[model samples]
Target: MTHISTTNPATEETIATYDVMTSDVAFDKIEKCHEAFLEWRTKSHADRAPYLRKIAAALRDNADAFATLMTEETGKLLRDGQTEVKLCAQIFEYTAEHGPEILADEDRKHSGGEKRGMITYAPIGVIYSIQPWNFPVYQPVRVLASNLMAGNGVILKHASICTGSGLMLRDVCMKAGLPEGLFDVVIVDHDTSDAMIENKLVRGVTMTGSDGGGRHIGQVATKNLKKSVLELGSNDAYLVLEDADIELAVKTCVQGRLYNNSETCVSAKRFVVTEAVYDAFTSAFVEQMKAIRLGDPTAEDTQLGPLSSAEQFDTISEQVSKSVEGGAEVLCGGSAPDRTGYYYPATVLANCQPGTPAYDDEIFGPVAAIIKAKDDADAMRIANDSRYGLGGGIFSKDEDKALQLARDHFDTGMVRINSFGAADPNMPFGGVKDSGFGREHGGFGMKEFVNTKAIYLP
Candidate 1:
């Protein structure tokens, strides 16, 4: 009898309500997904690739409708929604084209070349995915694209706020010739979700959310002896070196911060600038943040949109307030406006030091925390001081030096030099430390839930 209500954060209106599935119903769906996996696993990778291509074409064909639905449900900009659809389509295409090559069986010589051996990547059963509202389509597609190509069925328990998008994606896949039950979305309460995770049919669990959620899911998967991949939240830092292009750094950082209305996990939340360029970068960054147009998400000129929900707005507001109380200076925006919906203006916090939320926590909104470093070394040190290391960036005129630093010094899972990006289908994505474990994309995801069976021919 329980249900989830989808709301438009930009308009503060309920879009639709979906009934939550009972434990029995959820289990039935899981059973069906497992059955689909059994049948899907029997197909060759070549056979699977065409369906993925069809899915990609369907995504493009329906991009407008899907993007509008996402924007309506999550308050993301219309353009952003469209971009997400395109990105997801690209992910499906990439997985279809490259998955088989990545999952091909490997031949090796055993015991000093005396015997022949082979290692095959075999599909497991159902993979349970728990995704977030931000980048609703991309988050789920990122997991689904790889798993589908790997011949594994997927079951999604998406964020309550974006349940509609989740179900829509499932429908889209099915409409694109994906077999029934190959991808399923379950609307359920927390208890039901936990029960699903505990279900023996689910061989692996992949989640993209906060660290707290990741910990709970990871523990459950561990206790049940199921594999898991967690992509948790982070307060990623973007370092501006003394020799950096201040203008370019400011521009890129602004785009990164406000990309998803500044609700992205990998968005540059913290700005660590060397003393030499700190003033310039901070001034320009604050000015840009101050001038951002925050209004209707459908407006083409609007640069920032509302937070995904009132709860999300409250969280960001409290984080900013606590940071200010902890000795951080508000450069532009520090409080919510009196406007309707869950709108929070683009905010910039400076004079940030350790022991402050601005310095330590992830501000999941249109807020930027600026930190001053004595030099490049100090900037690097400051960037590595965070407990979360999901992703980070460094900007320097010397591309070689920046590349080396990112390769050898940056402690995060993914890093960008002289630019910023959320993800690339061909590159490995994930993080270390409290940011959670396991990589996605870049052929890594296609094998995460696959069994590597070893065979010896003596």
Candidate 2:
């Protein structure tokens, strides 16, 4: 394909088209980005702080326009898109405020306290980031802010569906005084992307996608001995323990499953309920899932929007069908609505056995899998059965018990006790197992692509 086109998932209409760039052009841009990094690397961490502040300001200034574009391009709800912009701005602000202290040189005594050792975090070269479409603005911004603060150039290979959002982000940064070529958005296909990964100029690669995709990228980067961070998929399980608050569990599980049109990687996908409260929890959970108001993303009252594309809609539909055929029973919605856009109804599945997609795979849609457990111990066992361990939740009126389960028993990277929420800039993010490795946010991402040099003073 010579060009890439952006489509409105809600309207199924073409929003815009972008001409694809050749490998030669992408290489030239990479070279220029490296040159820019050469200059940026000379700046101290304190000197790099104001640029992030300026970028944060630019994001806020264009929040409305950028949010609308994201909604049109990816079927993100208008309110959600606006919130995403704000979160991206907040990430920049957090990095700006904390980066200097986080990356400052540390003096240590070595050789029996006779020699002084100085450790410095220095920027590497260009970092290539391949991001997904779920949180268009926030995904790229999280990477860009920390790396820029670390004085590294960045190249974004955003999902084709949200190309407009990618360009809009770059434009906002450039307008905020980011140097030209310091951050570039490449318009290319996956083949070109893979080749670009092997380029000598790019010092590191970070990607957010499925485990399969993560494996491919990690292999390519590792083959060339380049560092990579993979934030992959998750089939997060929210356990409704025997002592759980039925009402709170129902409400939070519903909110977690349905947020972001139920496409979030770490959002609640499996609901493991203890038999003592299984019936009560499923009854209210299914009712709420069925009550979700799916409509145009721009509307104020719409609780859910369409899937990001027809392909996504079909994939979710197939997963549901296969799960049902494999013995899962639909408690509420089980099919797509008879509508013009790529819309799938919020669905609830019970009698989910281990052989079915609802139980075994990560269904990236608004379909909740309700699994019955013998007790609280069995519920934790079921939750830990999954191969992916990204994020999860444990609900119980006994805060101490819930905290213990989250801390000692839960196998996920992040476990929310008696609550449900997404990314917070102050907290560490990323997961283990098939969900991928490495940490982001909370000052960890700034060091992912940096050179930690040890200076020995004689």
Per-residue lDDT for 407-444 in model 1, tens only?
99999999998898999999999999999999999999
lDDT of each: 0.93, 0.93
Clashing pairs in model 1, backbone N/Cα/C closer than 3 A: none
- What TM-score would each prediction reach against the true structure? 0.99, 0.99
The deviation in Å at residue 295 for candidate 1 is 0.6
For candidate 1, the 10 contiguous residues with the lowest summed lDDT are 1-10
Q: Flag regions of model 1 displaced more than 4 Å.
A: none
Error of 1 at 236 (Å): 0.4
